[model samples]
Target: MENAAWYVLPNEADIETPSLIFYVDRIKENIRLLINMIDDKSRLRPHVKTHKCIEVTQLLLHAGIKKFKCATIAEAEMLGLSGADDVLLAYQPVGANILRFIKLIKQFPNTNFSCLVDDFKVAAQLAEQASAEDCIIQIYIDLNVGMNRTGVLVNEATALFKQLSKLKNLSMIGLHAYDGHIHDSEMRVRKEKSKPIIEILKNLSKELEEIGGRKLNIVAGGTPTFPIYAKETDFDCSPGTFVLWDKGYQDAYSEQPFLPAALVISRVISQPAKELICLDLGYKAVASEKPLLNRVFFLNAPELHVESQSEEHLVLSDTKSHSYKIGTVLYGLPYHICPTVALYEKAVILDADGNIQYWDIIARKRKITI
Candidate 1:
């Protein structure tokens, strides 16, 4: 009695369509590798900025990772609310938005919260606010290790540490030195570049202790430099990207050890020619910063090439004359996971059978300016 022309209905929600998905098994394995790589005295304070998903955070928590390094107050707040006992805000807070920070403190009164500061004035302000609230705030001294980013110069960090020690409500907890710019195509070169920075940190730790300053609790590193720093340095590591390994990290290592859990599931919306195809997702879906280098990878069609990407369209050319018809699904591995994740509203979590289990995008819009 069934009609011969009946077609199977496409369930867009059940498929990984334009959504980032995390393979839980792969994530757990990577966490195991990270933990096994470290010594008994080491701790893993994985950066929460990479995934920013409470689910992924929960998985890391279950994997014996209690300490987390967050880029924004929102991320810290989210982790605190989601039952993360300790969270560190690894960015300097600016502006008059002290109310938001205070709210977070009050909301998670029992939780251990900290923030990074390069200047004593800002530390004093935060201490003043914490003092008014009758709360203690932990502070991390951010030292510049040749990145020339948000940290204070290595030579100037000790003076800043002295200033922070005077703040009544602020407790100097640890040091944070992130060498993000030294990642290279060669592992030896990257490790060699990080040695001087690690040496500076060791010396700084010694100087801080000599002055009878507060003991260092957390010495953190960003995700990209974790491998080099983990082996050489005696500090707590913070590598977030290892949870959901991306194409960029894979390319940098030149070895594909981890599976590409997060992918942009795009469909061919147009076919301009027999050898050319266009996709619906473009710069808005993936990162536009290093488009040519980071993006344009083949998952299903190795012969297909990602020629160009506009705001909303991706032009693909098949060099081997592989014709892609309209409505064909393609998976792309993004170069940078953080920025690409920030662009989406939701992520689809997949099961072992490639079935969409659930979608979580709760922290996607939890960005704070301060």
Candidate 2:
């Protein structure tokens, strides 16, 4: 089907502008491809940072994806609410969040909740809290693995893993590394860049397992290295963006065939100039971290180029085009779907039957009754 046929909502009149719309058929297809990409369905612990809605989580769980990864407490709680089998709180919690993490575990007895640990003090804090509550929280060593964003270096991580194991109420499941920094348009380049880190993590897990006397579960990489890590049996692939893939990954990673499953509907509210049009979609509506040209790709109006954006209005201008008029609807695919999804309270889900329903972006909040 053409982009218009798939992206244009049949109940467009019912929905408001600057809304997040999910094409359920495409999302289901993406999940199918994601599972088929990996050898073991258990190894596919997809991240929930993209589509935090419980409905999407249910779709994944129904598709046989038992394990999941997320960055926030709300995401983990959201997973727990869905009766998720294994939920990894992929971020290292500190300060008050440590207690909140414990509360999540206590609240959701059925869901196995785990977290990442880079600092021993934080692990001890969590262990103390868990011990006090008489509950256990599973943890993965958050390794740096060249991201430099968070996590300890390999040398430190190896020692940290050994130290974290001795603590009570903290289950040392495996090593967790996010190679989100490795999205090189070319798969070969991505593979090449990811090799040393993958090897290091694998060797570390192998050595750690010998000491611990069990299989060390390593959750590694994101959408960019999903295919690369799919080749590794030990590493659990925790790609988040594949559910509602964006223009960035679609344009960068050609090897992965996951279709774009979500879109932002924006209407031309005003045409201030012959070549300038204003949209209801602004930074508040869609993700705005990328440059004006790369923020959102107008699937219908490829000619439209972003000129400026504020909280409530997005201005577009095309030097040679003057055909766009007020009330002209445009479908946009965000450059980064993860953060974009967080901008909305709920999504307008367009089901396979062309019916529209509202699904709360449940985990979008920082806290969810935890």
188-269 per-residue lDDT for model 2 (tens digits): 8988998898889878988889888888788899888889889855588988888889999999988889899999999999
lDDT of 2 at 97: 94
TM-score, candidate 2, is: 0.96
lDDT by residue for model 1 over 116-218, one digit each (tens)? 8898777778888888888877778888888888889987887887777778987787888888788787877877887888878888888897784446864
Q: lDDT value for candidate 1?
A: 0.74
Q: Best-fitting candidate, measured by lDDT?
A: 2
Full-model lDDT for every candidate: 0.74, 0.88
Backbone clash pairs for candidate 1 read none
Error of 1 at 284 (Å): 1.3
| All-Cα superposition RMSD per candidate | 4.7, 1.7
